[model samples]
Target: MIYLAIGFPPAAKSCAYRMRETANNFVALGWDVTVLTIAEESWEREYGLDHTLSDAVDPRVRIVELPLAREDLATDIREFTEERALNPTRWSKQERERHLEHFPELVFGGWRSALEQGLLDIHREFPADLLLASCAPYVNLAAAWKLWEEHQVPYAIDFRDGWSVDVIGGGEAFTRDSEAGRWEEKVLAEAVAVWCVNDPIADFYRERYPRLAERVHVVRNGFDSDSVPAAHGAPNAEDGLTFGYLGSVNFKPEFLATVLDGWRAARERDPLLARSRFEIRGHIGAGASREANAHMALIRQAESDGVVFGGPVAKAEVAATYGRWDALVLMLVGGRFVTSGKVYEFMASGLPVVSAHEVDHDASAVLTGHPLWTGACGLDAAGLADSFVEAARMAVEATAEQRAEARAHANRFDRGLLMAPAARQLADTVRPALLTGSTQG
Candidate 1:
């Protein structure tokens, strides 16, 4: 199988975990999986690299790195041409227009030719029966379509979020007559299957293309068992509880301000919270603003309020980080369409969660029955302040049995358990003979 996984492993992007597990599952199904991603150095301008992430990938999987990159993310002033250096904003706008001529995606569209040719070269040498493409460099769909058009090789898409749907802003991203809409319609018309991370996204695709309704399936981004702590004890409020927010800080500056305001209010109202600490762990801004952005400034100013910024944790150390936190703060953007991968990991940690997102968010669906969740309080500072206090109460009073039950609620979201059935089903469609003798490890 040729797996078009641009952020496969070693890259610290949140999608790496899902991409790693998907490729590993194919390898386990007796398929010689080869992942195609960009060079390691390319990630330096984006999220940087986390070599620890590559440690979990199956040894049998072969990774092919292409010498492609996002030139827009280039930070070095020396790398900039005279025209770009003079007015970078205008230069970037013109570049984006040029990029759109090659493909619909702005940042990754220029990679189209390289990706298409790369797939052709790989196919001529080894001959893959199936092609599985993961999107967002949704340009991979173009390559997948290219291989299928020329060689008749079947393909599937791990379209975690549907292309036409604006998940963050909540509506259609483009009209059906738009270039991107045309591309999505054409590519998905021939796809063997389409997998979405949640039901809302899958349903959107189903409604958009009723003919492919049966092909669209919900394959939730479940938590990796290894990333969750084996156990967590009740919070020691006297010693001061620790609240953690672990994931990309991609939300808007205003959204973060509301969360910080709530945290400050909670600290003032609750004596335990005043003594406690809130640790923000994850990558902040990328490129020129990496680790230096408005988010960093807000966190820095909150130092007196017991907030510390611990930038980016390695995937291998995730379990240990969860072990140290008394509770979790699920700060996310978007409404019903968004269900972040971290929500599952946070739930699996068995820690009390204080939701700092929309009231009607998809995460609310997942955390519905979780015993330790304080529930969604919208993005209102006063509401979120109450949630923090409630989470503190739950964290301090939760018994061993309660924590165990909280973890139990998330067992259904174990990454392997969620991905294996989909992998086996897709593999069976193209290579049933291989699976007859195949046994999952």
Candidate 2:
């Protein structure tokens, strides 16, 4: 199988975990999986690298690194042309336009030819039976389609979030008649199956393309077992407690401000919170604005309120990081459609959870029956403050049995359990088709 996982291990993106698991699961299913991703330096221009993540990948799964990189993320002045150096903003705008012309994928469309060539070259040497394309650089769909057009190789898409769904902003990202929508429709039309991270996203795709409803599947982004702590140590809030957020800080600045404001209010109202700390560990931004964005500035401003930005944590250290925290702050964006992988990890940690997102969020769906969870009550400062206070109380008073129940709730979502079956199902469906194709041709 040729797995087009652009953000595979070492990229340090949240998507990398799902990608790695997908490829590894395919290998475990007795298929030789070749992961197509960009070079290590390309990741450096984005969230940087974490070699530790590569440790989890199955050794038998082959990886083919493409020479592609996001041109917009280039920081070196020497790499910039005279036109780009003179009018950087205008150059970027023109580049986007140029990229859109090739594949309607915006920043990644220009990479279409290189990706198509990469797949074709790999196929000529070691023929592939199936293709599993993961998106965000939805450009992988173009290559998947290219291989299908030329060689009739069946393909599936691990559309983590459906291409046209505006997961963060809440609505259609583009109309069906639009270039992006057309590309999405064309690719999905030929796809044997489409995997979405949640049911809401799968439903959206099913509803959008009614004929393909049966082909859509909800393959939730489950937690990695190794990333979960063996046991969540008792919360000792005698002196203080620590509330930690371990995910990308990609939310709006105002959203973060509201969280900080709520934190401050909770600290003032609850004596336990006043003595407690909030440690945020994750990537803030990419390229020039990384760690130096408005989010970082706001976090810095809240340093007086015991808020500290510890930056990105390695995959190996995730368990230790969660172990140190008394409770978790699930500050996520989007409603109903967005179920971040962190929510699963946070639940698996067996720590008290304070949700700082919309009441209608999908994470609420996952955390509904969780024992130590303080419900998702919108982003209102007072409500969130109340949640903070409640979470602190839960952290202190929750029994060992309650924490065990919380961890049990997330056991169904262990990465291997969730992915292995999905990988096998795809292999089962495609292997016969490949046999038929080879026989006929």
**Top of the candidates by TM-score:** 2
Look at candidate 2 and give me any clashing residue pairs: none
lDDT of each: 0.91, 0.91
State how far residue 386 of model 2 sits from its true place (Å): 0.3
Note the residue pairs that clash in candidate 1. none
Residue 95 displacement (Å), model 2: 1.2
Off by over 4 Å in 1: 432-441
lDDT by residue for model 1 (279-352), tens: 99999999988988999999999999999998899999999999999999999999899999999999999999
TM-score, each model?
0.97, 0.98
lDDT of 2 by residue, 1-441 (tens): 898998898999999999998888888778988888899889999999999999988999888998889889888989899999999999999999999889887798999999999999999988988888998788888898899899888889999988899998777999999988888899899898999999899989999999989889989998998889877656677879999999998889999999999999999999999999999999999998999889999998999999998989999999989988899999999999999999999999999999999999999999989999999889999999999999999998888899899999989989889988888888887767576666111
State, as a TM-score between 0 and 1, how close model 1 is to the true structure: 0.97
Candidate 1 local lDDT, residue 422? 94
